[model samples]
Target: MSPAVDVQHIAKAFGQFQAVREATFEVRFGEIFALLGPNGAGKSTTIRMILDIIRPDSGTIRVFGRPLDDAAKNQIGYLPEERGLYKSQKVLDMMTYLGTLKGLKPAESRKRAMSYLERLELADFAKKKVSDLSKGMQQKVQFAVTVMHEPRLLIIDEPFSGLDPVNRMVVKEWLYELRQKGSAIVMSTHQMNQVEEMADRLLMISRGQQRLYGEVQAIREQYAIHAIIVEGQGDWSRLDGVTQVESLNEQRRGAVRLHLRPEVSYDDVLAAIARDDSLTIERFERAVPSLDDIFIQVAEEDAQEVRWLNRREAEREVEKEAV
Candidate 1:
């Protein structure tokens, strides 16, 4: 089957500010595709273009192998970063109304709305006004409404906003279930840990430019440092081929991170540790950088490049004035 969303070289700008620059990617069925970027990095603009909320300045977007139209729009469900609901309306009533707007009959919409409320542990709040619910509860109600119609493609921004850990897991499980049922999910969030746990593939944008795009694990491996994390009692700094050793705990008694020389393989380091009788080895493995680490690294790199470009431009203007 064709991907649920295919965006090719799409660019959008507001006045003189370019919000998205030649962004391109695909969201396939039965998978969670993460849209990652820092604030004002054009993620919202790109999503708007895909939803046809705003027309792109250039490039093409195909929803399910065809240009996005009324039918295509119906197949997409969007949960924006900002919540929108009738605050004065009761929870169940508002949800049911939203469901009908998505094409379900009144009875079916009400049934599904009630079922979702119960599943999300908000059944008791059915009669409560939307404004009376807590922020997290309101968030759940919005999510329930978004998926009640079971759109083929779901675009959710910060889906776990205001949610505690327990509720967060509930939403995560729901997304997994949707993916298993062949719904293409596009999640945009700043939570790197959640992204690492849930996303199959990701597209990261920096300064409105596509910085990284690939399978989550592949991208992590690409940014992996040549280091090992050892959890045991040992003088890791004494090990041969270990360039540096840093404590991974506050007490300095739990795990130590060993930075290895490029030429030394993991096996070689393991052998060295084994040879030292004083060292007690409990857990040893390669130290993989987390998504948070990668995100900061990429953002810092981009910022540094921008500063350099600004400096070059300033120098050019100075030279022109002198001439």
Candidate 2:
């Protein structure tokens, strides 16, 4: 089957500012992909291009193997980060209108809207004006409208923002169920832990530059530094082949992380500990870096490099002027 969404070297700019620089990626059916970036990193601009809210300066975006058009729009759902609804309108009425705009018949729209309202536990507030609902309830109503038409591809920004833990779990589980049913989902959020939990794959951008992209676990393994997590009751810091030791258990008995030196194999560490015969070792496992760690590290490194480049250019200009 063709991919759910294909973005090929798409780029956008605002006058002198390049908003997106050759951003490219794909989302497959039955998968949840995370689009991660810091503020103004072009994630929003990229989404706008995909939705045709704004045209890309270069490259293309295809939805479900076809160029984005009315037909494609009908098969896509978008929950924008700037959550909006007609505050004065009744929840059911607003949803019904939006669903019909997506091409659903009026009767079907109301049916779908009401069904989603009931499923989302907002049935009691169906007739209430959106302004009467709390911020979280309004968000739920917006989500209901976004999905009432049953779009094949879903794009949501900051899906967990403003949601309490209970509601967050509710929405998270619903997205998982949708993906299981073959929906291609793209979520852009700053919640690394949430991404770690649900994202099958991820693409991270920094200042409109691609920093990382891959399966979540595989990306973590790439930056894992070949370390081993162990639980033992001896001087693991001084253990052979263990160049660096970090206490995972707060220096309590037996829980620590050992970083293997370049020339030392993980097997060497295990063998040396075994040969000691006095250490009470319990657990030995490979360590994986967390997404949060990788995100911060990559973004900072990118920023530092950009700063260094700017400084070098400024120095060159100064020297040329003197000459």
Candidate 3:
């Protein structure tokens, strides 16, 4: 089957600067895909193009095997980086109104909106004016409006922003529930830990280009460092392939992070430790770099691309002056 959403070689430019360049990827059904990048990485611009809020200068976007259009719009739900709602309107009324725009009738919208509000613990605040609610409360209402119509695809940009830890957990759980119901979701967020927690796959872009896009585990494996922590009295420094080792604790009771020579074998290292009768193995495990580490690695890789481009531009300018 075709993917839930697919964009092939999409490019968007503004004047002399390209905001997105040859970006290509797809979101599989029933998986949470994350778009991760720093500010000005064209994440929002790319999302807008996907939603047809802004047409791409070049390339195609297909939703459910059909080209993007009005009918396809109803198949996708979008929660933008910026929140939009009528401040003076009653909470339930505003939510229902927005839902109605997505093809839900007023009665059906109200029923769905109220059900969500009550589940979100905002039923008592249903009649209250949106302006009277706190920022967090309004955010929850916005979330309600976005999902009430039950689109097959959800595009959420920074869904965890401005949410407290408790509320963040609530929203995270709700997102998983949506996925459990077979909705494909693409979430854009800077919170690496949260992305690692929820995303099944990741598409990282930097400076208008794709840096890394693949299964999260695969991406992590690609950047794995050959290092491990050994928690014992063993003098890891004497082991073959041991590049360096520092006492992890002043009391000599903590694990050490060993930097290994690329050619060293795990068996050789273990053999060395085994010879140390005084050493008692408390824990021995390979070091697995976290998502944050992977993010930094990929971002740096993209930054180098940007630097190379800048150098070529500078050289062209110098050649022009010589001419």
lDDT of each: 0.91, 0.89, 0.87
Clashing pairs in 2: 232-254
Q: How many clashing pairs does model 2 include?
A: 1
Determine the C-alpha RMSD for candidate 3 after optimal superposition of all C-alphas: 3.0
Top candidate (lDDT): 1
C-alpha-based local distance difference test score of model 1: 0.91
Q: What ordering of candidates by TM-score runs from best to worst?
A: 1, 2, 3
TM-score of each: 0.95, 0.93, 0.90
Write one digit per residue (lDDT tens) for candidate 3, span 1-323: 88989999999999899999879999988999999888999999999998988989999999888788787787788999998789999999988988888989899999999999998899999999999999998888888788888888999999999888888888899999999998999999999888878899999998888888999888877877787778866556667688888556535577787888888877777777787776678887776667888878778877787799999999999999999
Judging by lDDT, tell me the better candidate of 2 and 3.
2
Error of 2 at 99 (Å): 0.9
Q: Write model 1 residue lDDT over 1-323, tens digit each, in one string.
A: 89999999998889999999878899999999999999999999889889999999999999999999888877789999998789999998998888888889999999999999999988999999999999888888988888899999999998898899999889999999999999999999999998999999999998889999989999999998999989888677888898998887536467888999999999999998888999988898889888998999999999999999999999999999999
Alpha-carbon deviation at 87 in model 3, angstroms: 0.4
- Sorted on lDDT, best first, the list reads 1, 2, 3
Q: Which window of ten consecutive residues has the lowest lDDT sum in model 3? A: 246-255
